[model samples]
Every structure is written in structure tokens, then in C-alpha cells.
Target: MYTLAVCAEMVFRDRPVPERAERIHEAGFEVEIWGWTRHDLDALARTPAHFSSMTGYIRGTLTDEDGAAELLRTAEQSVRAAEQLSCPRLNLHGTGLDDKGLPVVPVAGEADGPNWIAAHRTLTRIAELGESAGVVFTLENLNTAVDHPGVPFARAADTLALVAAVDRPGLRMNLDLYHAQIGEGNLIELVRRAHGLGLIGEIQIADVPGRCEPGTGEISYPAIARVLADLGYDGTVAMEAWASGDDDLALERFRSAFTL
Candidate 1:
């Protein structure tokens, strides 16, 4: 059976974490993936025992070779927090990127040899931490055109490459069609390719013109859903939508389009 996870960022709307959790529960979603520590997670954890997952990051203080050790340490802490709340998965962003739109490096010419080595070491450490925690970590593909410019893993190939470098059983890719379509065309083809490489862990969608809701704009979501069903993908098809107007109306429209 395919499952659905709502990104709390889509539904919370700056509300209190407890209110967000109650709303999510009321909406009938059992599992969720929340954003970085931008909300009152402690209170949210107090919600009824439901399957949940959290998104976190390795601190920037852990980017160097000496810092790589702390990458796994912080990842372990994230895992501990998840386990405390019975969360099984932890979504991650790559080092070449930042989730909060903060620039990490100065305008460099290009990713040279030293850069690659440092990045690989940190990724490897993160994978080790994830494996040890028995908590799968996924590198999400961000929309470089609008949501995330200049971030690595903006391209599907780059995401695939990072997974390759991480090279761990616990490492995978959070395949967001919105970002993939924004950075690269041919969403179905990319899904097939990633499946062939055994890298896809989660899938998400929204339209192009506006990330309002699924099928609200130019995205052919039914075709993508067909591909997902055809591939027998046993993973979550998360709804990463924005509901600025009527949230329920947008959700209903998304449900109609994503009906499988």
C-alpha cells in the first residue's frame, strides 16, 4: 500500500506545533516529515503516538575533516530525537546545500579536488551515523530555479552522484517531482533511472506555475502517478503543496488529482 506524508511546512502555517500536530492528525495522516528546528517540536512530540519522521541537518560546524566526526554525532542526536518520538526516517540535505537559504561558501570558481574529497568524507560519516541509528536518511532534491538556487543536488544526476558517494545501505534520495521537474525535465524518466539505481526512498509533487497543489498548474500528475503505480513503487507520495487561499479546497483538488 502506498502512504502519504504531509510536509508540516505546508500545513502548519506558522501555527503552534501542537495545533499543527492536532490538525495533521485530524486530517487523517499518520506519518509526517517536518522541517528544520523551526517549530515547537517538543510540544508536537506530545501528540498521540503516530508514525512520524523529522527533517534535520548536520551542523555547519561539522563540515570540515575534523568536523566530520560531529556530523555523525549530530545525526545521531537527530536519530535519538526521532526514536524518542518513534520516527523511522530522517530527511537530509546535502553539504553543498543549506535548507535555510544561507550561503556557505564564497563565490568559488568550481568544485575542485579538495572540495570533492571533503564533501565525500562528510557524506560517508553521515551515512555511517544513519546506519548505526537504523534510521534511513534521504538527500532531498531542491528546486534550484526558484526554491534553491546554486545548491548542489539541484540536478538529478548530482543527487544520484551524491548517493553513490555516500554508498551506504541507509542512504537514499527523497525524490520530489516539483524540484526534479524544475531542475530537469522528464520526471518519469528520472524516476525510472533512479529506481534502476535503487536510490529512491520518497516521492512528492506539486504543479509548476504555482506550487499551490497537485494538478493545479502545468504538471501532468496523473501521468506521474501512473508511472509510480506501474513501477509498483512501495513508498510514500508526499503532498508538498502550498495553500495560501482555501486550504481545504486546495487539498480536495490535490486529492482528486492524486487519487490512485
Candidate 2:
């Protein structure tokens, strides 16, 4: 069976982050968070919840010189924070996102050859940092049409290519299905391709159209669950979605979709 997790940052909006994490843990799910710099790490550490993953950097981009330096610097800080919570995986994006989820430094169109080369070099350095820090870093795919526009390397295929090129134990793909459903509809095939390449570090999910928990939207998560089972992907499957109505019900629906 796949290990299940929920993004505490999305649910229990009325409570503190630590309390939300505790609630998710009490419901038999591990927790995921974004931007550790915004939360009280000491308080989160006190909770019994096991952290699945957190944002790997506060500010940086994958394809620029100064941004690459910033990414590596904050990634090191993120690693230390991960240690406090015993989190084994740290998540990354192509660039830093603002409060509204827009990329801070948007790339207007497809990245050029130089951009790809620079991104690969930056990721290679990130892999080296992860190796020294005893943690794994995951590059997550995002949908450019909806939540994040103009973010370079936002596609699952792009993320998979970058990670595979690095081809190191310390670097892997986050492989978010919700974004894949929006950006590239062939979900099963994408999973197969990423898994076949041995590049998946973790998998995140949410139903499209509303970014709500499974069963609230068009995606048949149970089918995906079966596929993962067949693929023998015994890794973390995290729900990074909002509660459609009741948070508990949403979590139950998420669990049911993947229970198989």
C-alpha cells in the first residue's frame, strides 16, 4: 500500500498550522507544508505528525546565476529545518512563487537552450547539496494555464527530464497529478514514464477544476491508485487540496480514492 499524506497548509484553515498538522496526523495521515519560513518550526517540531515534505527554498529560480546561488543558499537552510521535523524530502519548483502563486520571475515562453543548460547545472548543484545534507530534493511540476503562469519548466515532462538528466539519488521528481491533469491530460502514461525512469521522489494529487480533494472533480483517483499499485510505487501520495466542504470529509474522500 502507498503511504498517505495531506498538506496541512490547505486544510483546517481556522486553526493554527501546528494544530492542523496534529489533526491530519490524528486522522492517520502524514503532513506536508509549504514555505517553512512562514511557520514556527519549533512548534511544528513539537507535534507528533511526520512531515512528508516542505518547500525546499524560500527564494530562487532554476535558470539564473544569482537566483541559482540564492536557491542553493536557502536550500541549505531548508535542509536544516527538515532535520528538525525529521522530514526526508524537500520540494522545489522552477522558480519562487508569490503570495498568489504567481512566479516571481516569470519566463514568458518556452525556455531556450541556454536556460535548459543553466537549469541542469543548478539542479546538479542542488543534488550535491542534498547529498551532503542527507536529504532528497524534489522538483515539482506546476500547471502554467491556471495556478502558475509563465513558470519555466512547469510541465511534468520538463521536470522529469531535468531530474533524469541529473540522475542522482539526491534529486527526484515530485510528479503532481493535479497539475499533470491540467497541463497534460495523459495521467497514467505520465506516471508510467516517470516511474519507468526511476525518477519519482513523491506524488501529489488534487482534483482539477476546483483543486479540491478527490471525488469532488473529474479525475478518477481510484484508477490512478490501481495503476500505482501495479507499478509498485510504494511511495508517499499526498493530497495538496482544499476541503470542498468539511475538511474531515474531504480527507476521508481522499483516503477512499487511494485505499484500493
Best by lDDT: 2
lDDT of 1 by residue, 1-260 (tens): 55666665676677765676677667766546565456555776787736545774545422366545655666777787787677777876544345565435322233556666776677677677778878787777776568765554446677777787777878888888888787787988998988888888777777886777875677888787778778878777777778757666666676666567
Give per-residue CA lDDT, model 2, range 140-200, as digits (tens): 9999999999899999999999999999999999999999999999999999999999899
lDDT of 2 at 50: 96
Name the 10 consecutive residues with the lowest summed lDDT in model 2.
Answer: 1-10
Q: Alpha-carbon error at 21 in model 2, in Å?
A: 0.5
- In model 2, the clashing pairs are none
Reference-based TM-score, model 2: 0.99
How accurate locally, in lDDT, is each candidate?
0.69, 0.95
Per-residue error at 182 for model 2, in Å?
0.6
Give residue 240's lDDT in candidate 1 (0 to 100).
79
